[model samples]
Target: MSTDEEKSSGSGRLLTGVAWAILLTGLWLWGRGAADGAGGASAPTTGDVAAVGRPLGVPLPPAREPLAPVGPSRVEIPSIGVSAPVVARGLDAAGAVEPPPFATPDTVGWFGTGTRPGAAGAALLVGHVDTSTEPAVFYGLSAARPGETVRVTRTDGTVAVFTIEDVRVVGRDRFDARKVYGVHRPGRAELRLITCGGTYDGKTGSYTANVVVSAYLTDARGV
Candidate 1:
């Protein structure tokens, strides 16, 4: 299949790409218990949220109608102090979605081929967990709890407001692509903020798992 850069106009489409499929497949190669490493300098994951998931009594707002397709320009999550520019990123040579460049550790990269931020499907926004010497834009991503707000400013000046529905530290061995990357609801516009989590492996230069934050469009407004 051709790459997003070659096949997309940033239209609305359900999350499906050879790159993403291959990506989760690769992550699935690691051992099942990789989410809890046996020996690593990696810090233990923690969060302030106390049972805020939808099943736990957190009231969620109604989903707004999916908007016309438009590229996202920025992402802001006040609960975790994330305000970063969004860049369109394509697949690497391995046919996996590429993260933002390390040179710009504070920027979030959008999968240009998949669903737009406020469109009918789930839009993916990925960021770095850390750099060589510093915490990156998504370093605090896991700290974000369910019921928080994630605002995506689109190119058309509409802000797609989403409410956090779930947060998970997905182990590489159990990387369920449909749960981690698929649409949360059939017609609701959804968003996902992903970053490295679990434990960091100095040898592999990557994390053992991923912090996946799931949210759905609850509101929409201009500016």
Candidate 2:
């Protein structure tokens, strides 16, 4: 197969792996919740969001013109005390976006193939919510309120300032790729910070939902 075909195949597999992971996580959460007699209620099935909680719809800030592209070196969220080095990552063997290693859970992973930070597209950054023992860099990401600032330090010694527009904890089953991963405005530079959240299932070793913080570039300094 050609290189492009290989990438496509890998991406397809990655999506499959993500879906299976979500399903297995839900099942495990349900079984464990039932076994623990936590309210003596059966665990909700996959896509059964009655117990997963409602989706949040935080208002976005006004769109602005895009800035020149620049590679990111670090990400900071002063509101939640997050400061981490940013590393570029591609799909894993399973085709899902490879997150920072568990050993270095404090680091953040950027989808290097897509739009660079401060550019006219959605730049994706993902990190672990927590390791087995402690909270990761993005653990408090969901608590970020609208209008907060997310600063991305670029390799060019400039900081791209993004203002938070929305924060939502979306269940894995109901995840909408287009809405969560797509660019809202054609010429606006946006950033997405993602981490796992919601109920944790020991059996599945995964969280029931993903916390996505959406922001857009409002200003830049040292440019």
Candidate 3:
């Protein structure tokens, strides 16, 4: 069986990238309000977010789309102990969204262009668990289990709590975009958490499988 840490092909990269970007943008947007002061309702202050060191590499594969801001703002998952600054951007060369690393967890990234985490559709969040030099910001994410709660603190000061419904390890080739990216029921919001897991392959410089977590809105306030 392939490990969860493997690098998926086109679809995997897109799926993982999009999810991470949304979560990452949420964090960034939470800290910075819009120019017109719109959507700053409950966003987090820059002081509340964690800082980080410089990025690792030049970020291979040129960025494909222009970087865009995230929705609502601020992403907080207290259960997982993840509170950090975020930066949003559009897709890059590999067609994956990129989020900047927050200071706390060595480094964390996101997908700049994708569904917002607490939106009506399947919101995605991606993060690195670890790298060669250090433990990644989301390294503890694998511990997330079904029935667990994921709270997304939006810019409006409203909080959306999602209940973990499913968690699985899938091969990159078997990734299903429609199921993962498609919209949910009307007025209902969903979220998908993704990360590389299983085993790392030095030859490919990626992982063998992907750890995917699915969550649905259980509660929300202050939209």
Name the top TM-score candidate.
1
Q: What are the models' TM-scores?
A: 0.76, 0.73, 0.60
Write one digit per residue (lDDT tens) for candidate 2, span 1-223.
Answer: 0012111121111112233345323323332322111222222333523222233774555666677788899999999999999998765454445556657878998877667888887777877666545677887887887878999999999999999876777687675454455565566788888776777644443456777777889988887
State in Å the error of residue 148, model 2: 0.4
Better-scoring candidate (lDDT), 1 or 3: 1
The reply for model 3, stretches above 4 Å from the true place, is 1-72, 99-110, 183-187
In model 2, how large is the Cα lDDT of residue 54?
30
Residues 1-223 of candidate 1 have per-residue lDDT tens digits of: 1223211222311112323333433333211222112112121234412222335677777888888889999999999999999998775665556667667989998877677898877677887676656678988988888789999999999999999988877766555555456664577787878776676544443456777788888899984
Candidate 1 displacement at residue 199 in angstroms: 0.9
lDDT of all predictions: 0.67, 0.65, 0.49
Candidate 1 to native Cα RMSD, angstroms: 11.6
In order of TM-score, best first, we have: 1, 2, 3
Candidate 1 Cα lDDT to native:
0.67
Off by over 4 Å in 1: 1-55
How would you encode candidate 3's per-residue C-alpha lDDT over 1-223 as one tens digit per residue? Answer: 1112323443222223333443333433432332222331321123322112123442222111211223535555566777644444554454334444323443333344445656554566666765444556566666666666777665556676787655555544444344333333434466666666656555555556566666677776665
Candidate 1, residue 117: how far the Cα is off, in Å:
0.3
